[model samples]
Target: MKKINLNSEIEELNPEELDHIEQALLSRAQTISKLAYAPYSNFNVGAAVLLENGEVLQSSNQENVSYPVGTCAERILLGYAGANYPNSTPVMLAIVAQRAGEETWASVSPCGMCRQAINETENRYQRPITILILCANGNVLRVKGISALLPLKFDDLNS
Candidate 1:
Protein backbone atom coordinates (compact mmCIF):
# COMPACT_ATOMS: atom_id res chain seq x y z
CA MET A 1 0.00 0.00 0.00
CA LYS A 2 1.09 3.51 -0.78
CA LYS A 3 0.59 6.47 1.50
CA ILE A 4 -0.37 9.79 -0.02
CA ASN A 5 -0.37 13.18 1.60
CA LEU A 6 -2.46 16.20 0.75
CA ASN A 7 -1.23 19.65 1.56
CA SER A 8 -2.44 23.18 1.17
CA GLU A 9 -0.73 26.54 1.60
CA ILE A 10 -2.05 29.17 3.99
CA GLU A 11 -0.65 32.69 3.91
CA GLU A 12 -0.74 34.60 7.14
CA LEU A 13 -0.92 38.35 6.72
CA ASN A 14 -1.64 41.43 8.74
CA PRO A 15 -4.78 43.44 8.03
CA GLU A 16 -2.74 46.33 6.66
CA GLU A 17 -1.02 44.10 4.12
CA LEU A 18 -4.23 43.43 2.19
CA ASP A 19 -5.23 45.50 -0.79
CA HIS A 20 -7.98 48.11 -0.50
CA ILE A 21 -10.64 45.87 -2.04
CA GLU A 22 -9.76 42.99 0.25
CA GLN A 23 -9.79 45.28 3.24
CA ALA A 24 -13.19 46.58 2.23
CA LEU A 25 -14.52 43.07 1.84
CA LEU A 26 -13.28 42.08 5.26
CA SER A 27 -14.71 45.23 6.75
CA ARG A 28 -18.09 44.53 5.21
CA ALA A 29 -18.02 41.01 6.55
CA GLN A 30 -17.19 42.27 10.02
CA THR A 31 -19.95 44.81 9.90
CA ILE A 32 -22.52 42.29 8.75
CA SER A 33 -21.51 39.88 11.48
CA LYS A 34 -23.22 42.09 14.00
CA LEU A 35 -26.51 41.40 12.28
CA ALA A 36 -26.34 37.67 12.73
CA TYR A 37 -29.28 35.92 14.37
CA ALA A 38 -27.46 33.40 16.49
CA PRO A 39 -29.41 33.43 19.73
CA TYR A 40 -28.89 29.70 20.11
CA SER A 41 -25.15 29.39 19.59
CA ASN A 42 -24.10 33.01 20.17
CA PHE A 43 -21.50 32.40 17.52
CA ASN A 44 -21.95 35.12 14.95
CA VAL A 45 -20.41 34.55 11.53
CA GLY A 46 -20.32 36.77 8.47
CA ALA A 47 -19.26 36.21 4.89
CA ALA A 48 -18.72 38.50 1.94
CA VAL A 49 -18.24 37.60 -1.69
CA LEU A 50 -16.72 39.73 -4.43
CA LEU A 51 -18.20 39.07 -7.82
CA GLU A 52 -16.42 39.45 -11.15
CA ASN A 53 -18.68 42.36 -11.98
CA GLY A 54 -17.42 44.26 -8.95
CA GLU A 55 -20.47 43.55 -6.84
CA VAL A 56 -19.88 42.64 -3.21
CA LEU A 57 -22.48 40.53 -1.44
CA GLN A 58 -22.48 40.00 2.31
CA SER A 59 -24.47 37.82 4.71
CA SER A 60 -24.57 36.66 8.31
CA ASN A 61 -25.43 33.36 9.87
CA GLN A 62 -29.04 32.68 10.80
CA GLU A 63 -29.75 30.15 13.50
CA ASN A 64 -32.92 28.46 14.64
CA VAL A 65 -34.09 26.40 17.61
CA SER A 66 -33.40 23.36 15.49
CA TYR A 67 -29.70 23.53 14.75
CA PRO A 68 -29.72 21.58 11.51
CA VAL A 69 -32.26 23.94 10.00
CA GLY A 70 -29.89 26.88 10.29
CA THR A 71 -27.87 28.13 7.36
CA CYS A 72 -24.29 29.37 7.45
CA ALA A 73 -23.19 32.81 6.28
CA GLU A 74 -21.12 31.46 3.43
CA ARG A 75 -23.95 29.36 2.02
CA ILE A 76 -26.40 32.19 2.39
CA LEU A 77 -24.17 34.59 0.52
CA LEU A 78 -23.41 32.01 -2.17
CA GLY A 79 -27.10 31.27 -2.61
CA TYR A 80 -27.89 34.94 -2.92
CA ALA A 81 -25.13 35.40 -5.47
CA GLY A 82 -26.34 32.44 -7.47
CA ALA A 83 -29.93 33.59 -7.44
CA ASN A 84 -29.45 37.32 -7.93
CA TYR A 85 -26.30 37.49 -9.99
CA PRO A 86 -26.27 34.36 -12.02
CA ASN A 87 -23.92 35.71 -14.66
CA SER A 88 -21.35 37.12 -12.31
CA THR A 89 -18.62 34.90 -10.94
CA PRO A 90 -17.51 35.14 -7.34
CA VAL A 91 -13.81 36.00 -7.29
CA MET A 92 -13.14 36.25 -3.62
CA LEU A 93 -14.68 35.43 -0.25
CA ALA A 94 -13.94 36.86 3.19
CA ILE A 95 -15.21 35.29 6.39
CA VAL A 96 -15.17 36.57 9.97
CA ALA A 97 -16.72 35.55 13.26
CA GLN A 98 -17.02 36.47 16.91
CA ARG A 99 -18.85 35.53 20.06
CA ALA A 100 -22.01 37.42 20.95
CA GLY A 101 -20.58 39.23 23.94
CA GLU A 102 -16.94 39.24 22.92
CA GLU A 103 -15.24 42.50 22.18
CA THR A 104 -12.57 40.92 20.00
CA TRP A 105 -12.94 38.92 16.84
CA ALA A 106 -12.39 35.14 16.81
CA SER A 107 -10.65 32.96 14.27
CA VAL A 108 -12.91 30.48 12.51
CA SER A 109 -13.15 28.40 9.39
CA PRO A 110 -16.10 27.27 7.28
CA CYS A 111 -17.89 24.09 8.33
CA GLY A 112 -17.75 20.99 6.14
CA MET A 113 -21.12 21.79 4.54
CA CYS A 114 -20.04 25.32 3.82
CA ARG A 115 -16.76 24.08 2.38
CA GLN A 116 -18.67 21.78 0.04
CA ALA A 117 -20.91 24.65 -0.97
CA ILE A 118 -17.88 26.83 -1.68
CA ASN A 119 -16.29 24.05 -3.67
CA GLU A 120 -19.46 23.66 -5.70
CA THR A 121 -19.56 27.40 -6.35
CA GLU A 122 -15.94 27.35 -7.56
CA ASN A 123 -16.65 24.37 -9.77
CA ARG A 124 -19.78 25.99 -11.19
CA TYR A 125 -17.89 29.12 -12.12
CA GLN A 126 -14.80 27.28 -13.31
CA ARG A 127 -12.70 29.84 -11.48
CA PRO A 128 -10.84 29.95 -8.20
CA ILE A 129 -12.21 32.06 -5.39
CA THR A 130 -9.64 33.54 -3.05
CA ILE A 131 -10.62 33.08 0.59
CA LEU A 132 -9.60 35.41 3.40
CA ILE A 133 -10.16 34.26 6.96
CA LEU A 134 -9.93 36.76 9.78
CA CYS A 135 -7.86 35.33 12.62
CA ALA A 136 -8.28 36.01 16.35
CA ASN A 137 -4.98 37.87 16.71
CA GLY A 138 -6.09 40.46 14.12
CA ASN A 139 -4.27 38.72 11.30
CA VAL A 140 -5.78 37.26 8.14
CA LEU A 141 -5.36 33.78 6.67
CA ARG A 142 -5.45 33.63 2.89
CA VAL A 143 -6.23 30.61 0.79
CA LYS A 144 -6.21 30.60 -3.00
CA GLY A 145 -9.11 28.24 -3.69
CA ILE A 146 -11.58 25.74 -2.31
CA SER A 147 -9.29 22.98 -3.46
CA ALA A 148 -6.94 24.01 -0.71
CA LEU A 149 -9.67 23.36 1.84
CA LEU A 150 -11.39 20.40 0.16
CA PRO A 151 -8.88 18.71 -2.09
CA LEU A 152 -10.84 15.53 -2.64
CA LYS A 153 -14.23 17.16 -2.98
CA PHE A 154 -17.25 15.43 -4.40
CA ASP A 155 -17.92 15.86 -8.11
CA ASP A 156 -21.37 15.11 -9.42
CA LEU A 157 -19.97 14.40 -12.85
CA ASN A 158 -17.73 11.73 -11.42
CA SER A 159 -20.62 10.21 -9.54
Candidate 2:
Protein backbone atom coordinates (compact mmCIF):
# COMPACT_ATOMS: atom_id res chain seq x y z
CA MET A 1 0.00 0.00 0.00
CA LYS A 2 1.23 3.47 -0.75
CA LYS A 3 1.49 5.63 2.35
CA ILE A 4 0.82 9.32 2.22
CA ASN A 5 2.38 11.63 4.81
CA LEU A 6 -0.28 14.32 4.86
CA ASN A 7 1.39 16.87 7.10
CA SER A 8 4.17 17.16 4.57
CA GLU A 9 1.45 18.39 2.28
CA ILE A 10 0.08 20.88 4.84
CA GLU A 11 1.26 24.30 3.80
CA GLU A 12 2.29 26.44 6.75
CA LEU A 13 0.87 29.87 6.15
CA ASN A 14 1.47 33.14 7.95
CA PRO A 15 -1.78 34.64 9.17
CA GLU A 16 -0.83 38.03 7.77
CA GLU A 17 0.00 36.49 4.44
CA LEU A 18 -3.10 34.31 4.16
CA ASP A 19 -4.98 34.37 0.91
CA HIS A 20 -8.10 36.47 0.57
CA ILE A 21 -10.30 33.38 0.87
CA GLU A 22 -8.54 32.27 4.05
CA GLN A 23 -8.89 35.74 5.57
CA ALA A 24 -12.60 35.79 4.84
CA LEU A 25 -13.09 32.49 6.63
CA LEU A 26 -11.03 33.56 9.61
CA SER A 27 -13.02 36.76 10.02
CA ARG A 28 -16.30 34.91 9.85
CA ALA A 29 -15.16 32.25 12.32
CA GLN A 30 -14.39 34.83 15.00
CA THR A 31 -17.78 36.46 14.59
CA ILE A 32 -19.59 33.14 14.68
CA SER A 33 -18.13 32.29 18.08
CA LYS A 34 -20.47 34.84 19.57
CA LEU A 35 -23.43 32.83 18.35
CA ALA A 36 -22.25 29.57 19.89
CA TYR A 37 -24.79 27.66 21.92
CA ALA A 38 -22.28 26.01 24.21
CA PRO A 39 -23.91 26.45 27.58
CA TYR A 40 -22.88 22.97 28.62
CA SER A 41 -19.23 22.92 27.56
CA ASN A 42 -18.62 26.62 28.33
CA PHE A 43 -15.99 26.28 25.62
CA ASN A 44 -17.30 28.00 22.56
CA VAL A 45 -16.02 27.05 19.13
CA GLY A 46 -16.49 28.60 15.75
CA ALA A 47 -15.65 27.31 12.27
CA ALA A 48 -15.71 28.94 8.89
CA VAL A 49 -15.30 27.62 5.39
CA LEU A 50 -14.37 29.22 2.10
CA LEU A 51 -16.12 27.74 -0.86
CA GLU A 52 -14.77 27.56 -4.36
CA ASN A 53 -17.10 30.38 -5.37
CA GLY A 54 -15.69 32.71 -2.68
CA GLU A 55 -18.66 32.52 -0.32
CA VAL A 56 -17.76 32.46 3.36
CA LEU A 57 -19.75 30.31 5.76
CA GLN A 58 -19.49 29.95 9.51
CA SER A 59 -21.07 28.16 12.46
CA SER A 60 -20.69 27.67 16.20
CA ASN A 61 -21.06 24.54 18.25
CA GLN A 62 -24.55 23.64 19.45
CA GLU A 63 -24.67 21.90 22.77
CA ASN A 64 -27.51 19.70 23.89
CA VAL A 65 -28.99 18.44 27.13
CA SER A 66 -28.00 14.99 25.92
CA TYR A 67 -24.31 15.38 25.33
CA PRO A 68 -24.34 12.80 22.59
CA VAL A 69 -26.49 15.01 20.48
CA GLY A 70 -24.10 17.91 20.46
CA THR A 71 -22.37 18.78 17.24
CA CYS A 72 -18.97 20.40 16.78
CA ALA A 73 -18.55 23.82 15.18
CA GLU A 74 -16.58 22.39 12.28
CA ARG A 75 -19.15 19.79 11.34
CA ILE A 76 -21.98 22.23 11.86
CA LEU A 77 -20.44 24.64 9.40
CA LEU A 78 -19.63 21.90 6.91
CA GLY A 79 -23.07 20.33 7.15
CA TYR A 80 -24.72 23.64 6.48
CA ALA A 81 -22.36 24.33 3.66
CA GLY A 82 -23.16 20.99 2.12
CA ALA A 83 -26.90 21.42 2.53
CA ASN A 84 -27.11 25.02 1.43
CA TYR A 85 -24.67 24.74 -1.40
CA PRO A 86 -24.88 21.16 -2.51
CA ASN A 87 -22.94 21.59 -5.68
CA SER A 88 -20.09 23.57 -4.22
CA THR A 89 -17.01 22.18 -2.52
CA PRO A 90 -15.25 23.67 0.47
CA VAL A 91 -11.71 24.86 -0.29
CA MET A 92 -10.57 25.87 3.15
CA LEU A 93 -11.73 25.88 6.75
CA ALA A 94 -10.52 27.75 9.83
CA ILE A 95 -11.40 26.88 13.41
CA VAL A 96 -11.12 28.81 16.66
CA ALA A 97 -12.33 28.34 20.21
CA GLN A 98 -12.62 30.58 23.23
CA ARG A 99 -13.38 30.14 26.89
CA ALA A 100 -16.71 31.42 28.01
CA GLY A 101 -16.64 35.22 28.32
CA GLU A 102 -12.99 35.40 27.26
CA GLU A 103 -11.61 36.89 24.07
CA THR A 104 -8.35 34.95 24.36
CA TRP A 105 -8.07 32.34 21.65
CA ALA A 106 -7.33 28.67 22.23
CA SER A 107 -6.33 25.86 19.95
CA VAL A 108 -9.21 24.15 18.17
CA SER A 109 -8.27 20.62 17.30
CA PRO A 110 -10.71 18.55 15.36
CA CYS A 111 -12.63 16.03 17.44
CA GLY A 112 -12.64 12.46 16.14
CA MET A 113 -16.08 12.94 14.69
CA CYS A 114 -15.15 16.21 13.12
CA ARG A 115 -12.15 14.58 11.56
CA GLN A 116 -14.33 11.85 10.08
CA ALA A 117 -16.80 14.36 8.74
CA ILE A 118 -14.03 16.36 7.16
CA ASN A 119 -12.62 13.20 5.69
CA GLU A 120 -15.90 12.44 4.00
CA THR A 121 -16.06 15.83 2.35
CA GLU A 122 -12.49 15.70 1.23
CA ASN A 123 -12.92 12.23 -0.18
CA ARG A 124 -16.22 13.06 -1.82
CA TYR A 125 -14.92 16.11 -3.57
CA GLN A 126 -11.51 14.59 -4.21
CA ARG A 127 -10.05 17.91 -3.12
CA PRO A 128 -7.78 18.72 -0.26
CA ILE A 129 -9.13 21.39 2.07
CA THR A 130 -6.78 23.67 3.96
CA ILE A 131 -7.57 23.81 7.70
CA LEU A 132 -6.35 26.57 10.00
CA ILE A 133 -6.65 26.46 13.76
CA LEU A 134 -5.76 29.49 15.78
CA CYS A 135 -3.19 28.97 18.47
CA ALA A 136 -1.80 31.08 21.30
CA ASN A 137 0.19 34.27 20.79
CA GLY A 138 -0.80 34.89 17.18
CA ASN A 139 0.48 31.57 15.92
CA VAL A 140 -1.66 29.23 13.84
CA LEU A 141 -1.84 25.44 13.84
CA ARG A 142 -2.37 24.81 10.22
CA VAL A 143 -3.00 21.52 8.46
CA LYS A 144 -2.97 21.60 4.71
CA GLY A 145 -5.41 18.76 4.23
CA ILE A 146 -7.54 16.25 6.14
CA SER A 147 -5.71 13.23 4.79
CA ALA A 148 -2.71 13.63 7.04
CA LEU A 149 -4.62 13.69 10.31
CA LEU A 150 -6.47 10.48 9.59
CA PRO A 151 -3.84 8.45 7.87
CA LEU A 152 -4.71 4.96 6.61
CA LYS A 153 -8.33 6.00 6.55
CA PHE A 154 -10.99 3.70 5.17
CA ASP A 155 -12.03 4.65 1.66
CA ASP A 156 -13.63 3.23 -1.45
CA LEU A 157 -10.45 1.42 -2.28
CA ASN A 158 -10.67 -0.46 0.99
CA SER A 159 -14.14 -1.63 0.27
Candidate 3:
Protein backbone atom coordinates (compact mmCIF):
# COMPACT_ATOMS: atom_id res chain seq x y z
CA MET A 1 0.00 0.00 0.00
CA LYS A 2 1.17 3.48 -0.82
CA LYS A 3 1.18 6.21 1.78
CA ILE A 4 -0.92 9.30 1.15
CA ASN A 5 -0.40 12.57 2.91
CA LEU A 6 -2.88 15.39 3.18
CA ASN A 7 -1.67 18.76 4.24
CA SER A 8 -3.43 22.07 4.89
CA GLU A 9 -2.10 25.43 5.96
CA ILE A 10 -4.01 27.55 8.42
CA GLU A 11 -2.52 30.99 8.82
CA GLU A 12 -3.38 33.75 11.23
CA LEU A 13 -4.63 36.75 9.35
CA ASN A 14 -2.13 39.56 9.18
CA PRO A 15 -3.69 42.96 8.62
CA GLU A 16 -0.82 44.00 6.38
CA GLU A 17 -1.18 40.90 4.22
CA LEU A 18 -4.83 41.44 3.37
CA ASP A 19 -5.93 43.62 0.52
CA HIS A 20 -8.86 46.02 0.72
CA ILE A 21 -11.36 43.49 -0.62
CA GLU A 22 -10.27 40.79 1.83
CA GLN A 23 -10.58 43.18 4.76
CA ALA A 24 -14.02 44.26 3.61
CA LEU A 25 -15.20 40.65 3.24
CA LEU A 26 -14.10 39.86 6.80
CA SER A 27 -15.85 42.96 8.11
CA ARG A 28 -19.05 42.10 6.30
CA ALA A 29 -19.10 38.63 7.85
CA GLN A 30 -18.61 40.15 11.30
CA THR A 31 -21.37 42.71 10.79
CA ILE A 32 -23.87 40.18 9.49
CA SER A 33 -23.31 37.92 12.51
CA LYS A 34 -25.32 40.40 14.54
CA LEU A 35 -28.42 39.83 12.46
CA ALA A 36 -28.64 36.03 12.56
CA TYR A 37 -32.05 34.69 13.53
CA ALA A 38 -30.94 32.10 16.06
CA PRO A 39 -33.46 32.29 18.88
CA TYR A 40 -33.22 28.62 19.75
CA SER A 41 -29.48 28.04 19.87
CA ASN A 42 -28.47 31.67 20.26
CA PHE A 43 -25.40 30.93 18.21
CA ASN A 44 -25.46 33.51 15.47
CA VAL A 45 -23.42 32.82 12.36
CA GLY A 46 -22.59 35.07 9.43
CA ALA A 47 -20.97 34.51 6.06
CA ALA A 48 -19.85 36.55 3.11
CA VAL A 49 -19.16 35.42 -0.43
CA LEU A 50 -16.96 37.37 -2.77
CA LEU A 51 -17.64 36.82 -6.44
CA GLU A 52 -15.05 36.86 -9.17
CA ASN A 53 -16.67 39.99 -10.50
CA GLY A 54 -15.76 41.76 -7.28
CA GLU A 55 -19.26 41.63 -5.83
CA VAL A 56 -19.57 40.71 -2.17
CA LEU A 57 -22.73 39.26 -0.65
CA GLN A 58 -23.41 38.67 3.03
CA SER A 59 -25.91 36.47 4.86
CA SER A 60 -26.85 35.44 8.40
CA ASN A 61 -28.07 32.15 9.72
CA GLN A 62 -31.86 31.67 9.59
CA GLU A 63 -33.32 29.45 12.24
CA ASN A 64 -36.75 27.86 12.21
CA VAL A 65 -39.08 26.07 14.61
CA SER A 66 -38.35 22.84 12.76
CA TYR A 67 -34.62 22.46 13.15
CA PRO A 68 -34.11 20.80 9.76
CA VAL A 69 -35.81 23.65 8.00
CA GLY A 70 -33.27 26.15 9.24
CA THR A 71 -30.17 26.98 7.23
CA CYS A 72 -26.60 28.02 7.89
CA ALA A 73 -25.10 31.37 6.88
CA GLU A 74 -22.72 29.75 4.41
CA ARG A 75 -25.49 27.92 2.59
CA ILE A 76 -27.67 31.00 2.53
CA LEU A 77 -24.89 33.09 1.07
CA LEU A 78 -23.94 30.45 -1.49
CA GLY A 79 -27.54 29.81 -2.52
CA TYR A 80 -28.17 33.49 -2.99
CA ALA A 81 -24.99 33.88 -4.96
CA GLY A 82 -25.79 30.93 -7.21
CA ALA A 83 -29.33 32.11 -7.82
CA ASN A 84 -28.61 35.77 -8.49
CA TYR A 85 -25.13 35.60 -9.95
CA PRO A 86 -25.19 32.28 -11.72
CA ASN A 87 -22.43 33.20 -14.08
CA SER A 88 -20.03 34.60 -11.54
CA THR A 89 -17.48 32.37 -9.87
CA PRO A 90 -17.11 32.55 -6.11
CA VAL A 91 -13.73 34.01 -5.26
CA MET A 92 -13.70 33.77 -1.50
CA LEU A 93 -15.78 33.08 1.58
CA ALA A 94 -15.52 34.42 5.15
CA ILE A 95 -17.30 33.16 8.23
CA VAL A 96 -17.78 34.41 11.80
CA ALA A 97 -20.08 33.61 14.69
CA GLN A 98 -21.09 34.98 18.08
CA ARG A 99 -23.29 33.89 20.94
CA ALA A 100 -26.49 35.80 21.60
CA GLY A 101 -25.23 37.66 24.67
CA GLU A 102 -21.54 37.42 23.96
CA GLU A 103 -19.30 40.31 23.00
CA THR A 104 -16.65 38.02 21.52
CA TRP A 105 -16.96 36.63 18.02
CA ALA A 106 -15.42 33.29 17.07
CA SER A 107 -14.26 31.73 13.87
CA VAL A 108 -16.79 29.14 12.79
CA SER A 109 -15.69 26.52 10.31
CA PRO A 110 -18.06 25.36 7.58
CA CYS A 111 -20.23 22.36 8.31
CA GLY A 112 -19.75 19.15 6.31
CA MET A 113 -22.68 20.01 4.08
CA CYS A 114 -21.33 23.49 3.45
CA ARG A 115 -17.92 22.06 2.65
CA GLN A 116 -19.46 19.82 0.00
CA ALA A 117 -21.50 22.69 -1.32
CA ILE A 118 -18.35 24.76 -1.61
CA ASN A 119 -16.60 21.91 -3.36
CA GLU A 120 -19.46 21.67 -5.84
CA THR A 121 -19.25 25.36 -6.57
CA GLU A 122 -15.52 25.16 -7.09
CA ASN A 123 -15.85 22.24 -9.49
CA ARG A 124 -18.68 23.92 -11.36
CA TYR A 125 -16.90 27.24 -11.72
CA GLN A 126 -13.40 25.80 -12.14
CA ARG A 127 -12.04 28.16 -9.51
CA PRO A 128 -10.64 27.82 -6.05
CA ILE A 129 -12.53 29.57 -3.25
CA THR A 130 -10.38 31.18 -0.63
CA ILE A 131 -11.81 30.92 2.87
CA LEU A 132 -11.27 33.27 5.79
CA ILE A 133 -12.39 32.26 9.26
CA LEU A 134 -12.47 35.11 11.76
CA CYS A 135 -11.59 33.91 15.26
CA ALA A 136 -12.55 35.27 18.69
CA ASN A 137 -8.86 35.45 19.45
CA GLY A 138 -8.67 38.47 17.15
CA ASN A 139 -6.96 36.47 14.43
CA VAL A 140 -8.23 34.99 11.18
CA LEU A 141 -7.67 31.55 9.60
CA ARG A 142 -6.89 31.52 5.93
CA VAL A 143 -7.42 28.50 3.69
CA LYS A 144 -7.03 28.41 -0.06
CA GLY A 145 -9.66 25.92 -1.16
CA ILE A 146 -12.34 23.48 -0.13
CA SER A 147 -9.85 20.62 -0.35
CA ALA A 148 -7.98 22.18 2.53
CA LEU A 149 -11.07 22.07 4.70
CA LEU A 150 -12.43 18.74 3.45
CA PRO A 151 -9.70 16.42 2.36
CA LEU A 152 -10.72 13.21 0.59
CA LYS A 153 -13.98 14.80 -0.38
CA PHE A 154 -16.76 12.82 -1.96
CA ASP A 155 -16.60 12.77 -5.71
CA ASP A 156 -19.26 11.26 -7.95
CA LEU A 157 -19.32 7.54 -8.62
CA ASN A 158 -18.21 8.20 -12.17
CA SER A 159 -14.86 9.29 -10.79
Best-matching candidate per TM-score:
1
For residue 65, give model 1's deviation from the true position in Å: 0.4
Clashing pairs in 3: none
> Taking the tens digit of each residue's C-alpha lDDT, what string does model 3 give over 53-156?
88999999999999999999999899899999999999999999999998988657899989999998888898889999887787788899899889988868
Clashing residue pairs in candidate 1 are none
Sort the predicted structures by lDDT, highest score first: 1, 3, 2
> What RMSD does each model have against the real structure?
0.8, 2.8, 1.4
Error of 3 at 77 (Å): 0.8
lDDT of 2 by residue, 1-159 (tens): 997644445555568877676677777888898899988889988999989887888899999989999999999888899899978899889998888977688777898889889998998788988898877565666787877677766667657
Clashes of each: 0, 0, 0
Predicted candidate 1 versus true structure: per-residue lDDT over 82-147, tens digit per residue: 999999999999999999999999999999999999998998899989999999999999999988
TM-scores for candidates 1 onward, in order: 0.98, 0.87, 0.93
What's the ranking of the predictions by TM-score, best on top? 1, 3, 2
Candidate 1 segments exceeding 4 Å error: none
**Which parts of model 3 are misplaced by more than 4 Å?**
1-3
Query: Runs in model 2 with CA error above 4 Å?
Result: 1-14
Tell how far residue 30 is off in model 2, in angstroms.
0.7
